[model samples]
Target: MTDGNPDRPVIVLVHGAWHRPSTWDATRAALAGLGYETRIATLPSAGTDPSPTASMYDDAEAIRREVDAVDGPVVVLAHSYGGIPTAQGLTGADNVTQLIFLSAYLLDDGESMYSRHGMDAPADTSGTFPLPENPGLALYHDVPEDVATQAVADLVEQSLLSFTGTVTRAAWHDIPSTYIVSEDDRSIPTALQEVMAAHATTTRRWAGGHSAFLAAPERFAALVDEIIRSR
Candidate 1:
């Protein structure tokens, strides 16, 4: 691993459902150019398991392990469904300096992602949740055509158990957090983003689709830098 600038905290990125760590390539590159080290927490719920049994708790454990590996201060940036596991994972992590929820779900204790959407938790949390018919339209609408197409093609099925699992603890409740709302997001409605943003320490609105970072990576990285520096 590259021993990055010691003065800056490592940025740990958690991608949303149906996305792999590669989805963060642009954003991570931009952050690297800005002199910050970065790491990715690959959630098991979104892996290539034919019959995925991993729950949000499993994803949370993955995130916890990632953060634990970092030796210094860390900032976790979670997108969409990634926030659910991110919250549960960092519950008692003292090295986590801040959390940035990027158009992400912010659920409270005992709340599952399904419950946040006004849907009852599934009694049987087996199988996987398939991606939408046109995931590119919903998630990367503002991104370039080729890039969006590739992203859509790379999408995977998310585990149903991940959504049905309730959060036992929320790290944001004890950690300083910033919520970035994508005003034009179609995947997660703007109104819902606003509601979730209420749980954050501060909120910022961006005029783009759900994966705005893919559309404008440098700008997104700059915003992340500003947020970190503000601390």
Candidate 2:
């Protein structure tokens, strides 16, 4: 597909499950310092929003709104569960020039976060899902203790339905894409990430955990900047 326009694209940030738009604060700040414009999607499955039963489709629609709102070219950067929705959201969105998947799931049409990962669709529990075993150690293994603790505390109840919803459109098929693989990710196995990343046009590997955006902010930001400039 064409680049659409010669102007620099706005960076659209999409956070994974259990996370709010605020989750991208550090990355946003770093990108801002580089004079890059950015926007984060407010996901319905993120828990704080009213809809507790929101599905991945809802998340995709939410992200689509943000992408369509931008006046110029757009580049989507999706993290973790954010990948599914962001990919669906960009369906036929010509303004979106490229997609950057960061330790993110890349599913095919008719596949889902649950099926692809072999996760049982979570039950309809009254409260949020339990934090992963040693969440801090798993998600932010390389991050500072305080930072990891704070990040965990900030997580909200992600809707279980989100994982079950199947992807209707795999936008990567039509758009240029890049995948960033986390070598030490404890949440999603590095091998699985590599399998899904095969769908991307290109891939890069880095040493970090699932939350590399936080643990390796400068390096992550630099990579993002490099991707943008190279485009």
Best candidate according to lDDT:
1
- What lDDT does model 2 reach? 0.84
Task: Report how far residue 123 has shifted in candidate 2, in Å.
Answer: 8.5
Flag clash pairs in model 1: none
| Residues 73-186, model 1: lDDT tens digits | 999999999999999989899999999999999999989888898898767778998787778788898999999888988888888888888898899999999999999998
Candidate 1 error regions (>4 Å):
1-3
Tens-place lDDT digits, model 2, residues 1-231 = 122233467889999888888778887777776667888888888775564777788999999999999888889999999999988878899999999999999999988877796776666633344557777777888887888889988888777778777888899999999999999999889999999999999888888889877886777888998987776
The number of the candidate with the highest TM-score is 1
Q: What TM-score goes with each of the models?
A: 0.97, 0.91
For residue 178, model 1's alpha carbon misses the true position, in angstroms, by 0.2
